[model samples]
Target: MNFSQIAQLLVLGMAPLGAGSYALCRAKARPERFGGAKFHSPSWYYGWYGFLWAFLPPLLLAVASWILRLAGLRPAPDWVLMALAMGLGLAGLVYAHRSVNPELRARNSVEGVIHWTLRMSSVLSILITVGIVSSVLFEALQFFSQVSLWEFLTGTSWSPGTAFLGAAGRETEGVAKPLFGSVPLFAGTFLITAISLLVAVPIGLFAAIFLSEYASLPMRRIFKPALEILAGIPSVVYGFFAAITVSPWVVNTAQALGVRADYTNALSPGLVMGVMIIPFVSSLSDDVLNAVPMSMREGSYALGATTSETIRRVLLPAALPGIVAAVLLAFSRAVGETMIVVMAAGLRPNLTWNPLEGVTTVTVRIVDALVGDQAFDSLETLSAFGLGLVLLVFTLILNVISAYIIRRFRQKYE
Candidate 1:
């Protein structure tokens, strides 16, 4: 149904709820009614109970109708469904109003509804994740059927420009076969991620240490929020900054030093992406360091240890798991980043060790494959899913390692 129709249905459902709440409130105040028994719940709970009774039926109806439509079935007209929903809501409201008695435990009923709502929300989230993985896996399987997994993983070249012609059965006999080697993409991705971590980890860790251990209260308050503002800035904005500002500076500085650098060098985007993710590391590491016990610091002082020594030996070790987790999380963020890499790092899948050279990441290649007018079943188009699946696996492995580190070594300080 349209927004207006949905709003009208919700209004019809909720009007009785407000009425029921106030009515029960007034009724409960009159103790002589129902032989002076105390209410099983507060009036607000009764109101919510009535609200759910009125709302759920119509919501279910709409969902069922929508599902049926998706399955290619003819459903009732919107107005007819809206009318049916209104009738169900009114009937529910009447039932709720009549059922309101001192013996009815509306609080329990309302809480049960809330519990189920939360459970359903969790289920929906899990289902969505499973659906996404399954769909990508299926498509990636199709891609691998055409291109061998060995070549895709170990090949050094990634020229897929003419793969479409092969898929369309029009490949010229003299043409070289399209190579799907993903090694360069993976290398570029890791190269950028390593550069970003190099810039982010030291700066972010030091900032966190200063905030958690050294900075004054006022300084910490001002700086922490200011630092976190970096996280709030959009990736596209960082991409723009990298492209317009950092890339040119890198090229010019390289030329001044008699070293050549591409305008789309990996360093520019890496630096920008590092700056963008500094808050992720800093914020998380700060919280973790702060969580280290005051008792540990006191013990260190009692042992005649200096502040720096205490932090290095005691707090850092204690919070190492959290710090590692934060670093890994940042690694995942850096690996998955697209906009900055796309804008600053050129789309050439170069297998090179030099950060000054332009290179493409998996995410950039995925975007390239899916963006233009290409056949849906083409090897080039399906390669996006293959890249996505590999990326997904990489992320999952990182998460598993992070979990293991946290679970195995995390210290519980009182």
Candidate 2:
């Protein structure tokens, strides 16, 4: 038998063994309950207690086998392993069923196990996050060992595909030395993000204000969901919309005004991304603005202030923390956006301020590198992890800045 067969047989054995143990424990516990004896816990707890004991030993053995394999231990014969697993499981079942008495605090024991299991699960999540970070850091460190950090940061050239090309995949003849400069990539990312923000912020904020304050209840109900529907649309759909429809329109509009524009310009994706981000700012800002104390609005009205004046002087200031948070969230979404930029924005990686020109982003390059035919250990492949590390740092810095802003805003406003 192979691994899958052994696993299947072990599972099949454990299932019936657990069920039989549960049945036996319940039958034994019931007679004591009907015989006028006080039970410390419910009858089901005894059943679960028996089931766990029967299954847990076998699971531990499997885990131990896996650990041993990882440590280069030879595998035992499949029949021997299967027999050992089944024999231990059956032994556990018999021992646990016999131990289930009225005085056994089976419920407490089960609950304690459940509590530990939940705690372990939470810890596992943290460990998984750590593992991901560690893997990226490790690979990025390897890349930096080959390519300088200063060159990656300051140099403008980013011709990794051509530079890192070779059969042996080393710094051999005909393979140009790699340029890891990330300035163009970061510039394009931020430039698109800046355009997206300019378009999204004012519109989303104003929409939020109108919905939460000015619009009638029925109108608010109708308009709010309609606005949020944009958020529900997939990024691919937005990408296609930008590429096919928006790009040509932008090009034509620029030409009509006697200005030059590329077909795969930055503005198109930026606009579509802005549209994508509208609901993030609008929905959250609306909720935050509404959460501002009603008394504040009443006070502004009592002061003979108009709606606009009240919002400027009272409501907005009070809701600044949440509003800032919403904008930060939108900015992050725009920064991380890939599909829209890949489809709409050109992959030229130009470090320019002009929105009509093409540009590429970190995520675009990361996808390109991973999907290429490069060897797994090659410089081209490892560059993805290096880019990932940079992306991770950028996102972490954004989050930290957002946290500081929120904390300062809360302290001042509260």
Candidate 3:
């Protein structure tokens, strides 16, 4: 294989080997550690320790090397660098393992590294969000400086054609509004999201209920995974399905009903997006629902409540906060969805409510504005950042509210 392929394989191999070595070390450190024996540390802790030693150094080296390359510095050959890094990393692991006491210093040190790793993962997510927000803010600030914020927001016209074509010094015939009037985009997003939730929520909830409350062990094993298969299909495939098959059918059906429908309207994409989000809503909701104490269920049943009634009144209420969190998370997913909307929803930004007619969403516009080659500072290009900022804010607010509610719910239960 080529260098890239070889690098990939080496990295992949390192992860499992590191994991296995850590597991071995943990097993060795634990005393009779079986049922009735004292152990040096928990088995899982040792596994994580091994994972740290095996994965962290090489990963860091690779990342640092890539950054250096980006900064225009040529590094040593990949094979030589990889070999030296791995050798040094392994030597460090060995030294730490032997020098640190398994019961005292090593355990805490390993645990500290693992904890730091976990915290780093969370920080990585937050940093990514901040980076996205910063990019949007910077670009939107540029766009706003060029075009008045009032005209951008309130003017009833939107044709980004001038921004793309660089039609400079033309006489002003009328106010040239941005093609980014969020009303139609937001409306389209909500309509599509509503449709998706409508499609996904009931089916997912029922599926979860069946899995958690009614299914036999064998059936649970079979169906839970089968349902999850929906989540695994690449979104591009869903987009294609919606574009080629579903859009035509929707147009035809709308025509039969005496409604004017674009071949690529909101309904097909919304419906497909709903299908895509089903597993997310259902899986999370089911897990939250299942987390409700069995004692609560039994107490309700003892009071003469039937299974369904108990589920509705007791279990559902108990799990309501988590369920809401799940739904909100799904809503965020729907809002941020790009491919399905891009492929299935018409690009025309019509400020109409007729779901049968064509409509566009913020994500659709962002894609349209940013995809082709154009002046980077143009309103059309920068409008993407503005749209992204709005979307980011909306989703961030939802996430915050969901997190607060869930945290409060947990405190109440505790």
What tens-digit string does per-residue lDDT give for candidate 2 at 248-357? 99999999999999999999999999999999999999999999888889989998999999999898888989999999999989988999999999778788889999
Go through the candidates in order and give each one's C-alpha lDDT.
Answer: 0.87, 0.87, 0.76
- The C-alpha stretches of model 3 lying farther than 4 A from their native spots are 1-65, 73-104, 165-180, 404-414
Rank list by lDDT: 1, 2, 3
Residue 96 in model 1: lDDT: 78
Whole-structure CA lDDT of model 2: 0.87
| Winning candidate number (TM-score) | 1
TM-score of each: 0.93, 0.79, 0.78
Model 2 bad stretches (over 4 Å):
1-103, 166-176, 214-226, 286-319, 411-414
lDDT of 1: 0.87
Report the Cα lDDT for residue 149, model 3.
68
Q: Residue by residue across 203-300, what tens digits does model 3's lDDT show? A: 88888888889999999889888888999999999999999999999988878988878877888988898888888878988898889888888889
